[model samples]
Structures are given as structure tokens and as C-alpha cells.
Target: MSHVHRDRKKLLTRVRRIGGQVAALERALQGEADCSDVLVQIAAAKGAMQALMIEVLKGHLNEHVVAGKTEAVRAREAEAIMQLLGRYAR
Candidate 1:
């Protein structure tokens, strides 16, 4: 079974929390909050998103790369993940 399948609830909870953070950011903007407060909220939302990304990445690594049946499959998985990481970094 996939790691996500096993941990769906936990992952969904993270997603919901990130959504809430985004909603809070939207409200802050709509309310014409102070520039510094809005920036702080943006930072919080970014951090939450990054945390969710890391969680999903960890599941992908464990399920597809580390636990893959063959070296070629593992290498391919790792390569794909690295490519995504490269894009994300930019």
C-alpha cells in the first residue's frame, strides 16, 4: 500500500491546517490589516505550506525510492524527486 493511503488522515489534517492559514491570510488582506501584520501572516502561511510539502515528500521518498524493489526503480524515483526539489528551490 502507498504511504499516503496509510496516512491519509494525518496528511489531510495538515492540508486542512494549511488551508486555514491561507484563509486567515485572505481575511487579513480583506480587513486592510497593517502591512507588517499581513507580511507576518504571509510568512506563517508560507511556513505551513513548506511543512506540508516536506511531509508529502517524506512519504514519497519512503514509499517510492527507499522501499522500491529494484535499484533502477529507486534511482528513477530519486531522480524525479530531485528534479522536483530543484524546481521548488527556484
Candidate 2:
């Protein structure tokens, strides 16, 4: 099974927390929160998203790329991950 499937509960929990952060951010905006407070909310939501991405990326690398059965397969997986990272960076 895939790492994501294996860790579905844990990942879902993180996702839920991130969702809460986003909701809070929306509420802050609707309430006309101070600029600094809004900025902090945005930062919190962004950080949560980054953390989730990193966790998934790490799992993919460990399960799909590093543990691949063949060198060619591993190379392909690594290349795909690199491409994904490039797009994510932009």
C-alpha cells in the first residue's frame, strides 16, 4: 500500500488542522481584524500548508523513490519529484 494510505488518519488530522487555520483566517478577514492579526493568520495558514506538503513529499520519497525496486524506477520517481518541486517553488 502507499505511504499515504498507510498514514491516512495522521494526514487527515493534519489536513483538518490546516482547514481550521484557513477558516480562522477567513473569519479574521470578515471581522476586519487588525492588519498584523490578519498577517499572522495568513502566516499560520501558509505554514500549515507547507508542513503538510513536506510531510507528503517525504513519504513519497521514502516509499516510492528511495525504496524503488530498480535503479531506473528510482531515477524516474526522483525526476518526477524534482519536476514537482520545481513547479511548487514557482
lDDT tens readout by residue for model 2, 1-90: 999999999999999999999999999999979999999999999999899999999999999898999999999999999999999999
56 Cα displacement, candidate 1 (Å):
1.2
TM-score of each: 0.93, 0.96
Model 2 earns a TM-score of 0.96
Model 1: per-residue lDDT, tens digit, 7-74? 89998998899889889889999997999989998999899889889988999998999899999999
How many Å off is the CA of 31 in candidate 1? 0.9
Using TM-score as the measure, the top candidate is 2
